[model samples]
Target chain A: MNYSNLFRIAIRALIRNKLRAFLTMLGIIIGVASVIAMLAIGEGSKQKMRGQISSMGTNMVMVMPNFQRRGGVSLGASSSMALKYTDVIALRNEAVDVGAVSPEIRASGQIIYSNKNTQTTIYGVSEEYLSIRKLEVLSGRVFNANETRSMAKVCILGQTVVENLFGKGADPVGLSIRIKNLPFLVIGVLKDKGESGMGQDQDDLILAPYTTVQRRLAAIDYINGIYASALSEEKSPAAIVEVEEILRRTHKLKESTENDFRVMSQSELLKTITSITDIMTYLLGAIAGISLLVGGIGIMNIMFVSVTERTREIGLRMSIGGRGKDIMKQFLAESIILSILGGVMGVVFGYLLARLAGSLMSSQAIVKTQSVVLAFIVCFVIGVFFGWYPARKAANLNPIDALRYE
Target chain B: MNTIIEIRNLRKDYHVGEVTVHALRGIDLKITEGEFVAIMGASGSGKSTMLNILGCLDKPTAGDYLLDGINVSSMEKDAIARLRNQKLGFVFQAYNLLARTTALENVELPLFYNPKVRARDRREAAIRALEAVGLTDRMHHMPNQLSGGQQQRVAIARSLVNDPVLILADEPTGNLDTRTSFEIMELFQNLNEKGRTIVYVTHEPDIAKFATRNVMFRDGKIYRESIVTERLNAKEILETLPVEVIEEFD
Candidate 1:
């Protein structure tokens, strides 16, 4: 028999019992919709995290001193003096992949301006800090290289620090603030940076020249850490390797000795976040796939009942001239049509569900084209798999016995 | 006349819980083209079994059966199905028309199984077959809307749509009234006069007189075979029957 005729006949048979056919498709519709919606939400959250991380800085790598041991007692990274100014200078000069390098010194003190005092951490960095960390001067200019070299007592105020010391919308440029009881002139005010993924208020700090902090406020000789930016994200790993090579040689650490410094790139943090999201996506997909399996079983159950109900009709067709293959094709076509129709409806509903979920969660839910195609293919395969046994049973019926059936 | 069906020593056995039931025992029959043959028997006489074997719905245990010179007993299931499509037409006692379908679509059913019939040709052929059964005006009516006799006529039209070499009717008028039975028989006679071969199975001796030949079965074997020396014309009999008159109150 021709395919078109067989298809027509199958459709007619399904239409004969409209309520039963729709009931059979309901499971599949719900199954495909949940699968699509879950995957979209998972993918959306992952993308949102990536966007948050990128806003902090692009391709920024942090070099910190490892834990130091004194008299068999472990001192944390901040107490260690393993990283020095010379190592930072060597990394900036020797590493080709490094775009900008800044040495950092950390201190926390009370900043007082016009009787409004606030306690905040102050970071002493070089002039390259603005470009490497992607910080913008909102109102005034940043400290020049000459000011950093001359050890000028100039500082930059973060948005939170400006608000805390001089009230909201205050520009602290050319204003004096005391840190560690020493007066410092505000050179610039940075743009607001909101909060980091770890719940740290990013706009709650201050910036000063490393030389000024090391020589005047903290009275320190060795630097605490170094920050460098790679030319691009792809070159981050290579830049880390170059930084490690330069730092180990500059510190005069032998090949057998373990290095006292560590180089970490933004890509490492990205890897951790992506892996977590990947697990979440798979977990959601697997749960949704179980419902699809149940839907397939529902199809199988309906097909079995249909075959039993139509035994007499099958016998009549066989007697008239239909082969076993034709009977099988007719039944299989009914199931496939049901699943494909359900799949189409499911995709539309799933898209709407994802959009609704995205708005409620304040995240962007993206429905990937690949997920839609794969879900359809999966539904088609399920139809064939579940439809096979019942169709085969229908085909194997004895016409004489079937015709005699009541 | 060309021989349309030939059987020699045909035998059928049914195993009912380890007991052998002989359905057909050594039956030899020959039916030629353009002949209207009636097979008469009781319920257990195995006439239905013979009809099933002739219809290619069942295979005989040991026999050589030929339909239109082809050895159907030795053919596989699919091959026999193909042969049935090309050679045989069947009308059941229950008038097995598909429910919820127009008479035209029910008649078009058989043509869909024939690969050689195009869609447009199938519709045209179905219409022609319905016209032959005098159902042209009711072609688009659903089976449920049609009378028992009209539904049987639709079944007949369906059987003839494929233009088979032989038409098989199993008590075609079993579910109809006397007037409707005579009307169907008249249609059969009209088709038979046009050179269409027919094989009919029934238990009514009165109904058997309409056929040109009669074969009687007793206990899985043919007991009597004879040509009807005097045939009954269904149209003439229908005219002689009293007709009910409805009174007009208006």
Candidate 2:
């Protein structure tokens, strides 16, 4: 028989028992829907992470003091005090790949502006620090070279710091805020940077000249860390190497001695985070795949039952001149139609479900065209794979016995 | 008349585990176009086996059979199926109509397997077959909705839809009342009078008397073969039967 006729016969048979047919399709629907939604959610989170990491600063590099070992007992990196202002000056003067360099010395203290007092970290950095860390001044001016050379008591307040001191949406530029009982002028209010991927608030610190923080607040000679930026993202690795070489020479470390500082690039961090999210995506997809396999088994189970239930009808068809292949094709068509229909509905349902879940989680879930196409191809394969054996069983039935079956 | 079925020493064996039961030891039969023959036998007399072999539903253990001039004894399953579709029709005792399908579609089934008949032609042929069986008015009703006699008539229409060389009925009236049985037999006779060949199996002597010839089987062999000297006219018998009453409800 022609395909159209076969499909008609199959459809008519399914329609004869609507409830059973629907129940059979439900398994496939749930399977495809979960696969699509899971993949979409996984993909969405991956994209979100990439965006957050890139936002920190393009081509950024960080140099920190390495852990110092004293009699086999290691002191943590933060207590080493290896990175210094001279090493930052050496990188700035000698490195070509590194575009900007700024030493950071952190000091935590209570900031008082009138009656409002909030405890926050103060970052001692040069004027180039704003560009290297991708921070923008909303109003007023940043600390210039003259300010850093003169150890000016001028600070740039982050959006979070400003909100805590003067309230939300209040620009505190040109106002004096007391830190460690030392009144410092707020030179600028930095723009909001939101939260980082690790859920840390990016805009909850203050920026000042490294000279002033080292002498007045922290009373430290060596800087805590150094932040640098490459000329472009592609040169981040070269910039890290250049910064490490400059720091080693300034520290007068011998060629055989191990370096006392750690240099890390933002791209390396991006790669690590991307690999983690990729693993998560595959794990979600595999769990969803199991449900799809169960759905295929469901189709096989129903098809077998249908064959057994319609034994006499099969015999009648065979007697009327239907070949074994014809009977097989008719039943196969029924299952294929069921799964394909379920697949179409599942694609639509999955898209909607992903959107709903995305809103609930406050994240955007992306549904790619490839996932939909894959779901369809998988559905078709599932139909044929699960449908073949049962159809063959129906075809192989002896006409006489089937007809005689009660 | 053209010979539609010719069998030579047809044999059928059944293997029930280690036991071998000879269902049909050896039987030779010949049936021609425009003839009505009834094969009558008790249970296990091999009449059913013979019918199965004749319908090409079963392959004989050893035999040379020709159906409508074609050698069918050694044909493959698929080839025999095609031959059956093109040259044979069948009416079963159970009326074997698909449930939830209209009588018209059930009648159209035989023609569905015939590639030579287009969809439109298939429907027209089914309609003509239903008309021939005098069930044109009930053609739209489902098998369950129709009376037993009407259902049998629909089955007969299905057999005739392909316009085959032979029509085989296995106890076509086995599930019907006496009056309904006569009515079905009368319909068969009417079709036979139009030059359509027919073969039926039955154990009831009265039912076998409706055919022009009778072949009785015993012990897996033909016990007797004879022409009916006093053939019963089913139309006359149906006329003599009391008319069925239709009850009215308030």
Candidate 3:
């Protein structure tokens, strides 16, 4: 028999019992839709992370002190004060891959401006800190070497701190604000940088010269951390190695002694976060695939019932010169059409659902073309795999007995 | 006359567990083209079995059965199906019309299995077959929408659509009223008069009286075979019966 005839006949048969056919397709629709939605959300989060990391400067590296042990009791890494200004200088002088280096220290305190006081983090760094962290000064200037030598109480306010201390549209440049009873001059206001992928507010801090914060405010001589930038994105790995060696030599660590400082590049963090999201995507896809398998079983179940109900019809066709293969083809075509119809509908619904989720979560949920193609291929395979048994049963039936069947 | 069907020493046995039931025993029969032969036997007398074997729906255990000079008794399943499609037509007692299908499509079913027929030619042939049974006006009606005699005519139209060498009907009029049965018999008589070979099986002697000859089967063997001395005309008998008053609203 020609395929057109078989397709026409199969379509007619399905249309006869419209409700049952749709119910059979429901399983497949849900299976494919869930797969698309889940993958889109997972892929969207990974993309968001990559964007966040790249925005923070993919060539930048951060060095933090390792954990400190006091009387055999281990303290957290934040308590370790091994990172020093001399280590930053050594990194700048010895490391050829290192482009710019800045010592960093942080303190949290209340800043007051004409009775409007707001609590915020205070970052202490050098003139190169803005370039190393890719931050731009909106107005005025950063602290110079003369201010650093005199331990001048000069600071730059982030957008969040500026808005909190001095309302919107008010330029705080060349204005003075109090930091925990110590008056500090605001030389500039940093431009706004939105929330990171981790949902942490990026513009909720203040920046000042590291010598000013260490000597004038905290009465400390050592620094908390260091920030450095490589010349290019690809050189960050080598830059990390060079910085580690410089720190190791400055700390006077022996060959067997463990280093007291840790160096981390932006791409290394990207790899760790991306790998986690990949596992989650794989897990969600696997769960959705199980539903597809259940959907396939549903198709098989309906096909079996259809074959049994149409035994006499099969026998009649056989008597009229329809071969066994013809019968098999007709039933197989019916199931494949059913699945492909469901697959097409699923793709449409999946896209709509992904868009809805994206809006609801305020993130970009992209439905990839590869996922749509994969789901359709899976549907075709399921149709054939589940349809084979029932079609075979119909084909192998004896015409005499089938005609005699009630 | 050319022989349309020839069978010698046909035997059919059914195995039920350890015992073999002999359904047909050493039967010999021959039917010529343009002949209306009725095989009469009660249930379990092997008439149904013989009809099935003759229609190529079943194979004989031991026999030399030939249709249109082709030996088909020992043919394979697919070959038998092709031969049946090419040379044999079937009319069942149940009418066997696809319930939800229109009369024209039901008639066109047999042509779908014939690879030689194209789409346009198939439709034309199906229309002609419906016209032959005088169902041209009701060609689009479903089987459930028509009366018993009308449905049987549609079945007859389906059988005629293929233009086969022989028409094998088993109890074709078994489920009809007396007048409807006679009406179908008249249609069969009209077709037979047009040089069609017909082999019908029936237990009702009253229904078998329209055939030119009768073969009586008893316990899987032909007990008697004789040509009718005075055959009844179905059209004449139907005219004598009272007119059937069908519901007018439908």
DockQ of 2: 0.82
Model 2 bad stretches (over 4 Å): A68-72, A77-79, B247-250
Task: List A-chain TM-scores for all predictions.
Answer: 0.86, 0.95, 0.95
User: Chain B TM-score for each model?
Assistant: 0.97, 0.97, 0.98
- Cα-based lDDT at residue B75, candidate 1: 91
Could you give candidate 2's per-residue lDDT for residues A1-406 as a string of tens digits?
Answer: 8887789889989998899888888888889999999989988888887898898886999998988788998876444788778888888899999889999999999999999899999999988898998889999999888988899999999999989989999988878999989999998989999988778999999999999999999998989889999999999988887887788888889999888989998899999998998899789988988988898899999999999999999999999999999999998999999899889988898899889989987778999999999999999999999999999999999999989887
What's model 2's lDDT at B155?
Answer: 92
RMSD of 2: 2.3
DockQ, ranked from best to worst: 2, 3, 1
* lDDT tens per residue, model 2, B99-127: 99999999988777888899778788989
Per-residue alpha-carbon lDDT of model 1 for A260-303, expressed as tens digits? 87889888888898899989988998999899889889999999
lDDT of 3 by residue, A301-338 (tens): 99999999999989888887888998899999989988
lDDT of each: 0.90, 0.90, 0.89
Prediction 2 global C-alpha lDDT:
0.90
- The per-prediction i-RMS, to one decimal, reads 0.8, 0.8, 1.0
Question: Which tens-of-lDDT digit does each residue in B75-122 have in candidate 1?
Answer: 988998887787899999988888888899989988989988998798
Q: Count the backbone clashes (under 3 Å) in each candidate.
A: 0, 0, 0
Error of 1 at A306 (Å): 1.5
| Residue A49 CA displacement from its true place in model 3, Å | 1.8
Q: Give the winner by DockQ.
A: 2
Q: For candidate 2 chain A, which ten residues in a row score worst on lDDT? A: A75-84
**lDDT tens readout by residue for model 3, B144-244:** 89998899999898988889999989899999988889989999999999999999999999989999999999899998998987899999987888887
